[model samples]
Target: MHINFPLILVIAVAVAGLLALLDLVWLAPRRRRVIAAYQAQVDTPDPQTLERLDKEPLLVEYGKSFFPVLAVVLILRSFLVEPFQIPSGSMKPTLEVGDFILVNKFAYGIRLPVVDTKVFDVGDPQRGDVMVFRYPNEPRINYIKRVIGLPGDHIRYADKQLYVNGEPVPRDLMRTEPDDEVPPGHPLQSLAKVDIYEEYLEDSAHLIRHKRLSQPARPQEWLVPEGHYFMIGDNRDNSNDSRYWQSDQMPRELWGMVPDNYIVGKAFAVWMHWPEPKLSNLPSFSSISLIH
Candidate 1:
């Protein structure tokens, strides 16, 4: 059977902590005084007493040292904020591979740790928010992507243009050239360079390299079912998202259409970029466009 690691951690920490707490709050004083008095009486610990005492300190030590740290992590990751690392180029230009990001735990709603059940009231995701969430297929694993469609939105992707509820979501040609260095692919050699002109997401428009050189016959139209969301990568043509996978093939373990529960939080800003020089040479954070 598959074991859930987070649940195991929580259970282990809880059990170890409760045992330790019992020892400290209820048993320590009494045991210590008894040991002292008995030692005075016998002047030496008997073999059985010595054997029992031998194991107590080790358990006490293990509980004392690790339980608090585990509990703190469980609380912080469960309630307030959690950090994650970007492992792929699925979000390339906006969030490069190796980028570390912070996800607001309470942004969508407060969820109990491990269980993912929402507890309190919270806000919903807007059009352009970059969000992190638990992959519906498996809550143990986390996935991050941009939120593109909401519930009941008749989302359509044809010839590279996004039509939401039949209204063409605006997009513009920013610059056209080989973005080969940008993503290591040759898609730019044939596609149009589209800049996201909306402000619902980032202030500076995110560049979506589209190779839409044709007429799309219902290229992809989806009536975003309830509770699930339509997700896409900043890299445009490169992401494996709602566009490619059919609903039945998508296990409920994956995010259902417009699932408010799958959402974890809205990403706010870039805290740090490494090799530091890349961001250092660029314009100030104020000048950076939060366009898409």
Candidate 2:
């Protein structure tokens, strides 16, 4: 089962803050009065007696200790930035499995965590940005993909080529080579060779890949509705992106479009890569670089 981490964090912060506030307003003053009365009765209270009188309840002590730290984490994660680990090759050649990346939370706009309601309009996603968003069909799950179409934009995918607003997006074949990064036993491994291309989307230039000799995906087209965006993965042939969101559970009209509210943040940089969890394989910082 998926854990709603944001909700949990918010609840923890609230509870901790409440306990601390209760101690400050009521319990702490009462303790102070008791200590003062004891001091009035005795000529000189020993250090041990004072310490015992001033001691806080265990629950209140824990709450005061944890509230500040939790508040800082919530602010940074909900508004500034958050780390994510890539779990699939859907964004291959750009992001690989186990690649840890940082997403700019306010890049698109600042939204209230858990509820996901945008309270400010910082900016809208531009074409060619690598965006992390909630899967429209299942908002609990997050997916990362490149922005392909904006509101009112027309997008077409045919013959493994992409078109935006009726113009063919330029893609130059760089090479056809073996991808050593392809995970073992992956379906794409059967197609040993992969074609690498430099696709230019607007001013952004990024590399994409397609399996050599693999059958082309069926052509598809989408007209992005207002308040929605179209997303596609860089691993053209291997991604489950806007081109193939059709499923029995989703309505036909909402299949290929991601709503604006589903936007999480813009993926800006990859900080590390550890392809597996074995102790022998340590995470490497060599892959640290800004996302194109």
Candidate 3:
């Protein structure tokens, strides 16, 4: 089952804050009054007795201790930056599996957590940006892909070439090399070799890869409606992205596009890579670099 982390965080912060507030408003005052009455009855106030009287209830104490930390985490994660791990090679050569990347949460806008209502407009996503967004078919799942088309743009992919607004996007072949990173028993491992290319999406230039002998996908075209975007993976033929989202099973209006509201953030940088969970293998920081 998918856990609603943001919702859980918000609830924890609220409960903790309430507990602290309860101690400040009701319990602490009552304790102070009792201590004062006892001190007035005795000739000398005992420090031990005063300390015991002033001690907070365990639940309240824990709540007060945790509130500030939880609040700060919520604010930072929801508005500033959030960390994510790449789970697949959909963005191969750009982002590898196990890469820990930081997403700029406020790059697109400031949206309230859980409910995801945008309260502030910072900016809209630009072409060529690597973005993370909730899957259109399943909002609970997050998927990352490159932004290919903005609202009202024409997008077409034919013969493995991408065309935006009737112009074919430029690409330069870099090299043909064996993919050593392919996991064991993967189908792509049988391909033997792949072609690497530097694709130019406006001013941003990024590397993309395609299996040398793999069959090309069926030609497709899309008109990006207002408030929606066209996204495609940097792995080209291997990615399950906006290109494949359109199907007879789905409604036409909801086909092959990422709605503005489903956007999470722009992936800015990769900080670490730990592909395997084995204790013998350690994570490496050598891949740390700003994402294109």
Write down the worst ten-residue block by lDDT for model 3.
246-255
TM-score of 2: 0.94
Clashes of each: 22, 0, 0
Model 1 residue 193 CA deviation (Å) reads: 8.1
| TM-score for candidate 1 | 0.72
Candidate 1 wrongly placed segments (more than 4 Å): 1-5, 35-56, 181-205, 211-218, 246-258, 272-292
Candidate 1 local lDDT, 128-226, one digit each (tens): 678887676665666777788887778888876777788876666655544443454555554544333322232334555553433344577888877
Which runs in model 3 stand beyond 4 Å of their true positions? 180-191, 245-255
Candidate 1 local distance difference test against the native: 0.66
Clashes of 1: 22
Candidate 2 residue pairs that clash: none
Q: After superposition, how far is residue 216 of candidate 1 from its true place, in Å?
A: 6.1
